[model samples]
Target chain A: MTINKTWLAGFVGIAALGLAAPALGQDKPDNLTIISHRVHQTVSTGEQGGDITKDWQDANGVGVEWVTLDTGALHERLFRELQLPETNIDIAFLLNTRAVDSVTKLLEPFDEHMAANPVENIDDIFPGLRAAMTFDGTLYGIPFRHASSCFHYNQRILDERGVAPPKTIEEMIEAARQLTFTRDDGTKVYGFLINGEGYANTVDLARAWDGDFITLDYHVATTDEGMMKAVTLLHDFYEEGILPSNWAAIKDEEVNNWMQTGRAAMSLNSCGRNRIFNDPEKSQEAGNIKTVAIPVSEAFKDKFDVAPAKVEFWTMVIPANAKHKDLAWDLVKTMVSPENTLKAALNGNGPVRASTYDSAEMKNQLPYADEEKAVLLVGRVPLPPFDNAAKASDIFVEELQAAVLGMKSPEDAMASVQKRVTPLLPQ
Target chain B: MGRRFIYLLMAAPVQVLLLAVIGMPAIYVLWLSLHKTAFGQVPEFVGLANYGFVLSDPYFWRAFVNTFVVVNIVVYVELGLAVLMATLFASGMPFRRLLISIVIAPYAVSEVIAVVIWKYMLEPDVGPVSAILASLGLPELAWTTDRWAAMTMVALLSIWLHLPFSFLILYSARIGLPKDLYESAATDGASAFDRFRYITVPLLMPAILVALMFRYVFAFRLFAEVWLLTGGGPARQTEVLATYLYRHAFRYQEFGVASAIGWLMVLATLLIASGYLRAMYKRMLTGDA
Candidate 1:
């Protein structure tokens, strides 16, 4: 039903007033605002945020205020506000997926920013990281944090069992079998546990078998024999009762708990988990945990001729409607500056820059720095550079999980996934 | 005329709020459903394409079937238990007040907390429930791994969550029954079971129908509990429409397809609700006439 013009005008007037009230009180330029999703401790702690904000104020001669939120919440907020012509966000810290998906439309390209700040030493950043931040030959993000999947095992358990950490897929399975036991109470203990419910889990398992869900050409690639092998290998873990029956519900934190309690002998976890082991308050198995590259199948070993390391990176980007785009770039430059990047690396939770890794500070901080470096060299990141990595991963993982649970055979699960995902892949 | 104008003036605010909050979004979603859009791209007009795509999708059909199965299981179980408990309470059992309070306690806990509590209880190694089963010499079951078992576990949780509301409504309806009917039934040599079947059951049907409708809707939209508990895993065997739509819209960012699926869900819910309302209306009219 159409309303009278007078009533509509009155309603519009009230909304206008409501919208105008917030804008009336702002002295816009004196303050630099940065909207970031790194609300958790390694990024925005009392020490970290305070130090960064103080340094930013010194560098830019402005009163800088930082607003922090979790990743998902920040995306919702930024997506809404940035749709408007003038967003208040000067800078944003988002993950690689969001940056790639939303950057061209929702964010301004960072090439101009980098070009203007040539003295920022952007070249010194790792090439893999730089490539990760670029989409369609234009820079969209600056790398901030890097992660890789590594096998975190209990040294005490392995030593007691007279077994060494597995370096190949077959050895890993044998070790997993050896570690499993059933108690008199009929409670079955596991040797290895990984998330079997989602795409990330499948991708982790697929890496060992050299399977790719989507190939570099961006086609559905899960119907291959290698993918089947990967699915079967994971299924065998469950079929043999070497992995927890509740692996589908298992989360990263739960995996950490299993390792810390010495309940599981091994888990494929992010390298950042090392910090948890080093923290006396959090870890029961501190000083007894060792990290190594994930085991590879014989075929993958021959193909890459090295142990496969699964590399993951986190990036920060500015939204298109950011009020202070220049200021945001300044913040990005400062945060990723060699000195600060090195500080973050030494603190055990930042991106791996070439300079940061070779620095004496990092060496002093990480006890296993040499071993970590060796593993990092051979790390393999997921390919195809699709914006739907998270969703694709979820589907892949769920399908693999079906195989693991014996609901579907490896071939059947992969075939089903191919049918579903093929249509969604970018041409 | 002046009085009518005043009434219009008074109602305009609510009408405008409803239009802005509900009507506009519904229209927007409908518009979106008829388009084609991929991640990081502008939408293009594609009349009926998304609907066609959704209709042909196996995942959509699977999720639709799963939703119905879950709804049916949860509703029937919850209704039976709720009616029984209400009758026992209506019979003036001892500690009626305490029993009523205890029966309604599960409603106080949020769905997430309920799922989390159950998850721990059903854990393979440390869960007390699994331990109990093992002690009883029963084969240890992976509650979230086996497809049928996972669906059953989710249905069980759904019923558990809806039980308190169903019981409260049925109990109130039972309490409201005419005292003379029960007296007449007892005097007529009606057995306890006969009294329940003849008097209590008939009287509670209205409340039961309402309770059933509410439970059906709640069980149909089940997402958080399922997501946190199983994440629709073991190969999407436990996936319902809501979780499937979520994966499409947010995770896949296929907004057009997601919107189409959403409209399909709305249509399905409407059809189910209409059937329910019609059945209840017919029952009510026939019983009264």
Candidate 2:
């Protein structure tokens, strides 16, 4: 009877041990899955596909499963996965503005994560980007590709016209008009190129003029008198032929072509696009491209105090359903380490860190690095978690385009957009 | 009883697949359309508020009209061109194989690739079409900005990509057509045109209906061309039902409204397709054209 009891005890112990083994195995994932739009360009193509990830794994003794998608599709996937109780996405890079909409729901607040896994140069990220990544006083993201807008121009054309870069909106208009010219062969050249069709397009100009398009409280500020003035100014530009004839339909890639081919003397484009202008293989007027801060409308600025430049950025966030938060955080830390972040800025899109602009390699690569950094100092992103921001943006852009297309007067368009957006704002 | 049981077992996998793939999603979409559900928020039963919003919205009406007009233009134009080409090919044109291969090339390329090519070709300054127009003293065509011009461009592209499919079906039907009817019509003092109008039209009705139905469904779901070329822009002039649905679902995160729009689209297609099916059934029952 004593021997039988001892055998029973041993059997129970073995059964308990068997049940715990699989649970222990699942405690750590072999590799983490990260999804982002630029993952392919930054990770796979950064150093011939697997070399970069392999090197990082070798150094840190970990592995990753990186997935790349287009920006629209990536967001769709993020939204779907976030709704699931168990998700495959361990980490993702989201637009900094989008993080506001997902904070504390789809994403885990990173204040604790950052504290537990301290990364060097975490404090060196640009203040605008850091603030943009924070929601309700909780940090939910780490800045990745934070870029600000700037006025880019063909320096050779400006020099030939004997006009310096414009410092005010009036000067910009005057310069653009003067720059429009016809050659001896009767080939007409455009003075300005504007991407008039995106969600962020005319809103920037309105914000510059009125100090706000939509207030932080989600009120309709686009119908303000000052904002209408900005709209009229753009309409005047269109009427005077200062902008391209197809300006009402132009998108971002067209602006790149116009600037690179030296057809447009000036353009308002993202500062990160400076890399394209600097690439000789891709640009026809590589050495002649230069950038400056977006000019302010002083008449409007005199009435309200706000930043002159508009900005937008992207950030990395860990999902709430992530299986390996520590490993994901460690990967983020390693990827954004001082040395790797610099490498990322050089290879991929914009840099997130202030030190990146100040680096020797960045200076060598980007001729207008200082101007880009200066723009960041005064740049402002539209505060997000604005109730239904995407919908509001679409409504505003549609009306703005109607004004641009001469279908409606500027005042009418602004009023129409305001009326439509009023009900959408948070009560 | 044993045979019946074996038959049910044999069909079980397919029924399960149909349930998982189609039945569940359709039911889910119906459920979603009746509720006001935002991402991260619990669904609230709204009882057709979404459908009401879709029906009342001016943008939805605009998109519906645009989809109807664009789909009709694409399908009819594609059908006419395919019939003409197929008739010619069947009547013994030189290098018929090569001509057919060339007509089918656009279908081989992916939609995105085809759109990219067309986008470059339509560019105002650098595209060859623009240069030719410039040389001819014509204004640069605002293919994307002008409402009618953008719609025409999209229709033209749709016809090009789908022409091959229509052509192949009609051509095969033409080849399978009985030759004795033509010979008898000729013997009775019928011209080529008469023979074609009487016999070929009646016999090819079946194929034509098939081609039209297929093309109508494909053209109704037009997204890639408009998205890549104009992005439903320049004041939403070229917005179609599919792109509109896409914006509400993906961009705006309003899946409930999108589902409502989607069901409306399905209903519209069903109503149109019902006419064709009824006609087809009549033709089958009467054994007439």
Candidate 3:
């Protein structure tokens, strides 16, 4: 049915009126608008909307406003708000992967703030996570939480197969080959499930395979031998049916679902996912799952003397154009303070503060605390900071998908990625 | 003159609304196209550099080609199918009301929801259709991975969701034709085919053109169906102009390039649409069948 003109007119009028009015908490002194995910709700003293801000205000004697968006839109929202400072969002909790490039253009350097008002136990933050929040030797953001890709496997499935947790890429592949089969009930169970849908997962595997697809200087090494091997290995898995036919379409949530429902014996998932697997309510494999360090690519095995896992972080930053930068830093300080970091850890966010891991409450709450802490020490950023990181990743993933689907050879795919990516990098 | 003034007064709100919604944005897009802007950076006036860059990019050109091809296919197929169904309905089929509702149901489903449903149904491993094919000892084709398969799937889904709108327009037009004309044709020794071709074809041309023009513009701006399905993937084979523009604007943060792409799309759409109108106008003037 067509929309009635009367109804349309009324709706538009109401919308215009609402837009004309100032938002509910815009005018108050010390009232800061923060953009972040609702995961911050986990750190709030009270339940529901603005509770974290209220709690922060009560504790620190300041007024604050909190707004949230999905993870996909957070970077775009933060970038837009920073560009248009009139939006009045003073602070943002953003992914560090995006923040690294955004810091110089959109965020204020916190070196001066750190010098003036040093956060207690700031040194206790994991070096990898702290490094992720820093750009060009100047700290741009404070670590809020960090997640690293790790090996999560169903122990019962492994035990039934009489296989050990894989420590190397070759061993993992062999185990996957052996464990993949259909059961008597005609249920198809796969051996390995990886979130191989995007660049992050591809980069994780590339790093493990010793493919220096990205250099320390933010140059694309897409055609590197190790990168080719990495792509080829994943393609081989797809070709051999060791992975599901729909592996190219699998995402993080599906990996979780596969692990939770025991459809897969092993999967490369995240520390945050381990929290879900350990929860009896959310997972059928609860108490039967185990977390191990991610297996390195056989080609790159020599480089991983310490056996590093892929690490990424979520951080809080003050925008350079923020009207109340100092207050924003104060809020950031409070949010990343040792006490609050511990609170975030307890909320199922991967702890960034080393001290938080030492807490008895953390030990009690996190079943994989030991594995996570160990991995954090060796966790590495798979892709370094660059201005065109997002675009570059998109190009890489497209080529990676082509290779995985046998649309292009590994060499050809990497060449395509390299050709596209070179133009995006700095001259 | 007084009545004209009253008409102007009546039209003022709509005129202003159109100006604000369409005219201003159209002008701003042209202005934005001349600048070099990325998210979080100050826009720099670059004087046609964005247009130069977009035009020179191979992927942009590919997207442009894909947009034209996919849109033309969807429009013609949908129009053909819609005209056939409308004619059948006008022929007095049984359960006409029920059939009409069933046809219109797809239109009621939101594009995003419909695309999601189609994506799941076509998914290779877990989808019921794929399972049934597998059970029949058929190969499980990777719908999103194969370029032609991906494009065809997106086009089919687009037609499925949008056919109802076109069908409804044509159906209404078909039913509105004078019944006495057909009676006269029958009396003149016209067969059913002859009656349709001689009477229905000429009369229904207006509705067909309208539906074609509407679907042309609509399909030309396709993004969600293809993007959600394959993300212009399997090596960007299914990428369309709109999705390409979105990549530049949002994902790549190149607002200037995106604006340039937007203006290009508008121009291309106008040229195609006007060509249709030009033919229709010539047909009208020439009294061509």
Positional deviation of residue B263's Cα in model 3 after best superposition, in angstroms = 1.1
DockQ of 2: 0.45
On the 0 to 100 scale, the lDDT of residue B96 in model 1 is 86
At residue A44, give the lDDT of candidate 2: 35
Can you write out model 1's per-residue Cα lDDT over A55-152, one digit (the tens) per residue? Answer: 77765667766777877777767676767778777766666556544544677788888778742677776666677666678888787776777677
Model-by-model DockQ, in order: 0.43, 0.45, 0.35
Residue-level lDDT of model 2, residues A1-427, one tens digit each, is 9999999999999999899878765556677788988653464337421233456666655577778899878876887788888787888988765764544467888888777878786878778777777767888878777667777888898898898887677787788898888766755668877787874546556555644567656667767865686677778878887776667667788889878887788877787787787579999999898876666777755643333466787777888887777778877777777676777766754776778889887888777788777767666676455537788888878888788668899889989988998887666
DockQ of 1: 0.43
Q: Model 1 misses residue A210 by how many Å?
A: 5.4
Measured with C-alpha atoms, the lDDT of residue A155 in candidate 3 is 87
Q: Candidate 3: DockQ?
A: 0.35
Candidate order by lDDT, decreasing, is 3, 2, 1
**TM match of model 2 to true structure:** 0.88
Task: Indicate the worst ten consecutive residues by lDDT in candidate 2 chain A.
Answer: A43-52
Give candidate 2's error at residue A242 in angstroms.
Answer: 2.9
Q: Is candidate 1 or candidate 3 better by lDDT?
A: 3
Once fitted onto the true fold, the runs of candidate 2 whose alpha carbons sit more than 4 angstroms away are A1-33, A39-65, A86-90, A113-123, A184-186, A206-210, A298-307, A323-349, B1-20, B125-142
Best by DockQ: 2
Q: Candidate 3 on A169-240: residue-level lDDT in tens?
A: 778878898878887776777888787557766665666665666766767777876677678888988888
Model 1 error, position A281 (Å): 4.5
